[model samples]
Structure formats: structure tokens, C-alpha cells
Target: MAQMNMIEAIRSALDVKLSQDPDVLIFGEDVGYFGGVFRCTAGLQEKHGLHRVFDTPIAEGGIVGAAVGMAAFGLRPCIEIQFADYIYPGYDQICSEAARMRYRSAGEFTSPLTIRTPVGGGIHGGQTHSQSPEALFTHIAGIKTIIPSNPYDAKGLLIKAIEDNDPVLFLEPKRLYNGPFEGDPNIPAVSWAGHELGEVPEGHYTIDFEKARLHTQGSALTIICYGTMVWVAEAAAKAAGIEADILDLRSLMPLDLDSIIKSVKKTGRCMVLHEATRTSGFGAELIAEIQEHCFYALEAPIVRVTGWDTPYPHALEWEYFPGKARVTKAITKMMEG
Candidate 1:
């Protein structure tokens, strides 16, 4: 099997979908000529032609609004906001219009739109360029949010997001775009150990939206996370010599609680980590659910190693983001308790 970087894998997925469906189209700033800021859409315009894969103005709201309209008109439009931080400008469109179209219209209408944007820190893109805004989108009633950790999930989830009838927020981690990109392009598009399986095939695949990927097994502790944190948690487990069970929550809104409960029951101890701020983050919700369903199995209080409740800082960005050291510390603390 040949290896491809995360960016290439995403491009491959989009290429496959657009080729198979005439209704599938991509539009965003610099998406056509420059192939997007990260080049995730590189060569797409050339292959699919400008009408299907074209560029748009430098307006996030306009991009999202256009997508909503196109989706209402029976086209599957994928809009790329240059950065996750900029998505807020279009949040109203996503939450009010795109998200509620189907529910508001009682199935008479739908918004099959996908909003793709690069997120996270570690590349020094600064506060404006790096932000994990999925928590906000996930809180909304109508949209589905997904964050992928590697090349394989990135491709599968993006494809699934595009095809789904609801408006989907596809948060791509910019940090994972570069480097070794360990995913195998020819490896049958199988779901990773802790990844959700989309409806994609070996020739072309789309992972299901609601499943959780279990990466490892252990009776000690269950480390629950998504996006880049999954990889970090695994590394921390290895470094601490702890057999931590890891769960990659591929989809945020339609969370796979079955996976969470099952893991907690086995490990009897749980720790949640994420790049988002500690207060009112996804970890809090998971902790509440675990307390409700798996309280008796708890050997210790559920520890959360998350970003501090502050604006994602510039200089202290590394500290703000949860790392292996913090993860190990949390696990050790749980073990001690």
C-alpha cells in the first residue's frame, strides 16, 4: 500500500466524490487557482473543471450563505473557510439557516453542505489562524461536527460529511497536514482502531458518522479524545508505560456514547483531554455522561487535562494545548488515587 500525506488523502476523497456525483462541487477562497491555503484542493480545479471546483470571494459569510443556497437547490456544496477562527463570521448562517433548514421545514428542505476549515495550533499560525471551534458548532442543535486525526479518517470523514443530508462542520487539524502522514492510501480505507467507519469502499469509502474508533485496550484507564489529541494520548501512554485505552471520537455531535460507556466499564477509570478550553468543553459533557452511566465502575474521579480557560494564547500556546506530559500526569494521578 502506498503512503500519502493527510492533505493528499483528503484531496483524493474529494476528487472521488466530485467525479462520481455531478451535484458535488467545491468553492472557497483560493480553492481554484491556489488549491486552498494548505493545498488540500490542489489539482482539483484542473481535474474537475472550474465550474465544479472554483474559487470564491474573501467572505466567510458569503461562502457559507452560498453553500446553504446551493444545498437548498439540490447541490452538495463544500465551502472552505480559510481558517477555523474566521468561521465565526459565518456561524449565524451555519447555526440558524444551514443547521435548521431540515428541522425547521419538517423535512421539506435540507442543507447538505460541508464546511471545511483548517484548525489547531503548533504551526505558529497565531490566535487568528488556529482555533478549535468545533465545540461551538457541536452545541448547536442541527449541525454535525467532525475532526479527523490522520490521513485515513480525514479522507473518510470529509467524504461522509459531504454526502450527509445535514450541514456538517469538517474541522481539519492543520498540525496533522504535514509530516510522515502515516496513513496508507491502498490499505483498504479501513477504519483505524478508534475511528468511525464511514460508508466508503476500498475503491472509495465514507466512514459512518456516529461510530467511535477504539485504538487500544487496557483495564487501567480510558483516555477519550479526538482530533490531534488522540495521537498525543497514545504517545503519552507509551511514554508513561501505561496501557491506556484510547478512543478517537470521530464525530462530536452524534457522539458514540456506546463506545464511551463500554470503555469506561472495562477500564473503570477515565480521563478526557482536548485542545479546547476546559470550561464548558466537550470533556465536561463526557464526564457527566460517565458519571451517570459508569459511576460505580470508577476507581477514581474522572480527570480532565484540557486547555486552560483563557483565550488560546500566542506565546503560551504550547502550554495551552494538552500534551503528553499533562496526559501522563493525569493518568498517574488517577493511578495513585
Candidate 2:
């Protein structure tokens, strides 16, 4: 076992994949020489030659398009889109081409590529640098969505995503890149240097993306969340003195609905939490599915605590973000009734 931060764990995963599979390639803006904007790919270019790890122009479309072509030609290409907010320019290649490649070719062609990007707020990135768009990708078919909250899961799930047969959107919560955040701005940011979640495996590992991890088992209520919201929900539950079953939904697209239903049915209450906007976020789909399966078992209406339906604000970041106070209030309300 090795104690590594999220960035180091991710870089280690890429290093292992590149070394094990000759066909695996990594490329993105500043990923080669500078080692990525956040240094997730730091020193990888020096370890692995430019052929296996190189830099690309500031073109999201071309980056994803070329990855699709490479994957279809039997090479496993892993591309990075600096931030989740900048992925729109490559929407055509991702949603249209890479997503439909297998079905369009009648299973003759498959785009086995991984698209990694940083998502969510809490770093005062305003609107452009911070956005959680997992719902957009989840709405589309033929692709898997992933968001890991800790370094351990980050490394394991990333390795699995890279080896998967279909395209995977691996969204990393930048705020949690070094340490876990629980939506409390008062507390100083923590690093993974000495945290238990930072104790990651040294080599290759895989965490099933379709499985939901039960962080805490309780019967009062169930809290379902992913990414940065997982930590926030836990903090809220603790603050509210609520014994709730917390489930970390590592994968969003191939959602572990069975696990969600089981928890909801056992607890008799459910609250979906996410960092995305409230209207059409992935939390909506989660609530819908829970309602469909656990309606009879539900003791109260399914609740959701999400960001407001407005662009992420630079000055009013916390106001827009659904923080611990917001989540605690929602859980308290649910338990009251």
C-alpha cells in the first residue's frame, strides 16, 4: 500500500496502464511537458515517451475526435478535457460519434476510450472552471459516467474505466483532488497526505463502477450522493445527529439501482444529493428510480438537495452551492415527517 494524493494516485494509474498496455495512449492540453494544469499527469511524460503521452492543441473537439478514431482502430486512447465545463466543444464527438460508434457500426466498431475532466465547485472557479455536467453524459446512451470522491476509489475506478470496452466519462472533483471536502468553508482545506483514504494500492486495481459503496449503515433514512456531495452529506448527517445510510454512487450511468432501492426500502426514507443544479441534475433521475421501486416502502417523499438553477457565481459561490447547512436542513425536515 502507498499513501498518495488523488493526483498521484491518478498519475500512478495512468503509468500502470501505459506500461501494461502498449496500445494505451494519453494526451491532452499541457499533459505531456507541463503534466496537466492540476499536475495530475505530472512526470508521466518524462517516464513514458511522448509517443505514449503527448500534448495536444487547445481543441476539445479534435482531442475527443482523434481519441474516437484511435479507439476504433484498436488503440485505447485516454483523453482529458481540462475541465468539465470545457467539454461542450467536444460534445459532437463524445455524444454523437464515440457514443454511437458501436451501435452505428452494428457492434463491429467500439470506441474504448476514457475522457477525464475535473468537475464541481468550491474552488471559486466561477462558471467556466467549475461545473458538474454528469447528467448531460448520463442522459446519453452507450457511455458510462463516473465520479470518485477519494484517492483510493479514484485510482481503482480510473483503472477500470481505462480498461472498459465502452467510452467512460471520469469526472474528478477538483476540490477533493488533494483532500476531501465536506462543504464547510470555515474548516481549512485538508490534504490526503495523512488521511486514511489516501492509503492507495501501489499497482493495478479495479473497483466495480456499477456498485454503490455503503459508507454508513442506518435505518432512520438513506442518503444517496456522489462526488464531492458524498462528503458533504456525511458531514450533514453527523451535524444533524441523524443515523442515515450513506451510499456513494461511484458510477452514475450504470447506476446501482438495486443498492439504492435496498437502502431506501430498509430505511423507509430517501434523500438524493448532488452538486449539480436542481432542475435536471442526475439527482432527479435517482429520485425517479427510487420512487418507482420504493414508493410503497417510502415513509416520506424523496427529497433532493442540489445547487440552485443559476450559473455558478464567483462572488456568491457558497450561496449557489448546496452546503452542509442546506443538506442538514433537508435531512432534518425529512426525519420530522
Candidate 3:
């Protein structure tokens, strides 16, 4: 109903969740007084008080370890890693402890924690600060991975991640923090299955985690993407005059195979795009699944537009990152088939 930036929408979700649940708490470096590096957690400390929203030492491992401890004790803690690239310091705590705790303890314990991190390249943050590491966590069994493309989904999905009873890796694209993408915020937050939108309260609401939302419909080709790439693909579609059907994959794990298959069957041509490196990225997995189900329907080979194989570069950021030209080129090539 109201227009808000991606950052504001995220704060709204966190604010609503904190107000609704005493079990919910937030902790991360600079998240308290500094209000996070990107200010996504701004003013939360004042609203919830320092006890519930406080800063942790500059240790990703310790932050994750403490979150696991809190979740085990029946608290829902939302922890933020300053950047996705730096998440490696806490990888052990996440994969070994937060992820496997429930299975290892035979349901005697569980960690209902949401790990939020700003990810991807475009801001000249260089290799260390910008990395899309979703594939790494998606490989793990116990974690739910998500990357939202715009403000509405950013708010809805973050709320969903916080409420889920397992470790959720919530990756937000830094590039889209103040996006100018076009989408209907009031289009009714329906599940990917076409079910009624989860009734998020005036105070708060959580969208379903496994559903894919179709941003625009077309018959020529389907562009499957998440995070900022969704916006890129849409713009490319317009520039190329290709009427590409855009699907925002709101959830990475428990991917909406049905939506993808159905869309591919109709379009017959598909392109997978992301800001992650081309080699061994999520695009490959989506290609495999689509080929499995829609092979006969496909008119062309599945195409991908992604970053180069090298680390995200500061000097060559634009070249390294896929843009509308690259995406349009890929779309035109796919259309030729």
C-alpha cells in the first residue's frame, strides 16, 4: 500500500517480528549503535532496547555460535553477518552446529535462527565484501536459502525466514537496496501455488517460503532469476523486445519446481540469470531440472547470463557483472533457436 525502499521494508519486517514475539532478538556487529553497515537494522536498538537488539563482537563464528545457543534455549534470534563473503569465519558454526543440531540431537534441540547478510557485486566493494554464496549453503541439508528481488518480497520473505523453525540463510542483494524496479506492492501476496496470500497482519505477515511469483507473463521465453538479477532480466526483456516471462524465485531451497516446469512448458525457451559466477552456480541446477521436465517442450538450449569466473573485481565491476546488454544478448541468442 505504501512505497518503501528495500532497506525500509526489511526493517518493517524486523520491527513487526520483534513487536510480536518476545523470543525474537537481533545481534550483529555494528547492528546496535551503528545500525548495521547498510543501516537495515537502524533504530531497532531504540525500539527493542539494547537487551533484545545489541551488537556482538566482531566474530561471525561467535555471533552464529551464540545464536545457536539462544535457539537451543527456545529463543528466536536473528543474526546478521556484515557481508556474505565474511560468512566463512562462521561457516563451521553454521554447517556443524546450527544446521545439524536438531538431527544430531534427535530432535531434543533445534536452532530457529535467521542469518541475514548483504550479498552480490555492483557497489565496488571488491572481492571480499561482495560474493553470492547461496549455492554453498543450499548444498547443506538443514538450511533454507532465500534472496529477494524487491522491496515487497524482501519484507515478506524476511518475516517468513524469522518464523521458520530452522536455520535460514537470508541473502539480500546490496545492489537492490534502493531499487527503482517496477512491481505492484499491493498485488496480493499469494503463495507460489496460487493459494491465498499469507495474511500478514497490519503489524506483520510472512509469505510462504517455497513459492515462485511470476512478475510478468510471456510466451517467447522465461527468465528465471532472484535478487537483483530479476530486475536486470526484466529490463533486458524490455530492451530486447522479447516479452520474457520473469519468475522471481523467492525461495532457493524447496524450489518451486512446479512453477518453473509449467512456465518452461508454456514458453519453450528459458534463460537463467544471476549475479553469481557462471561456473557451478544456481543456474546450472535450474537448467538441469528444467531439461529434465521440459526437454520435449524446449525450443532452444537453456541459456545463462552471469558474472565471470574470477573474483568480483573493483576496477572491472561492470564487465564482471551481467547487465542489460549481456542479458539482452543472451535473450536474442536464445530466441534465434
In order of appearance, the predictions have TM-scores of 0.92, 0.99, 0.93
User: Candidate 1 on 178-277: residue-level lDDT in tens?
Assistant: 5421122222333233333222243477789888888777778899988878877887787668897899998988999999999999999899988878
Best by lDDT: 2
Ranking of all candidate structures by their TM-score, best first:
2, 3, 1
- Model 1 clashes, total count: 14
Residue 243, candidate 2: Cα error in Å is 1.1
Per-residue lDDT tens digits for candidate 2, residues 92-199, read: 999999999999999999999999999999999999988999999999999999999999999999999999999999999999998889898988988998888899
Model 3 CA lDDT for position 123: 73
Window of ten residues with lowest summed lDDT in model 2: 209-218
- What TM-score does prediction 2 earn? 0.99
Taken over the whole model, the C-alpha lDDT of each candidate is: 0.82, 0.93, 0.86
Q: Give the candidates in order of lDDT, highest first.
A: 2, 3, 1
TM-score of 3: 0.93
lDDT of 1: 0.82
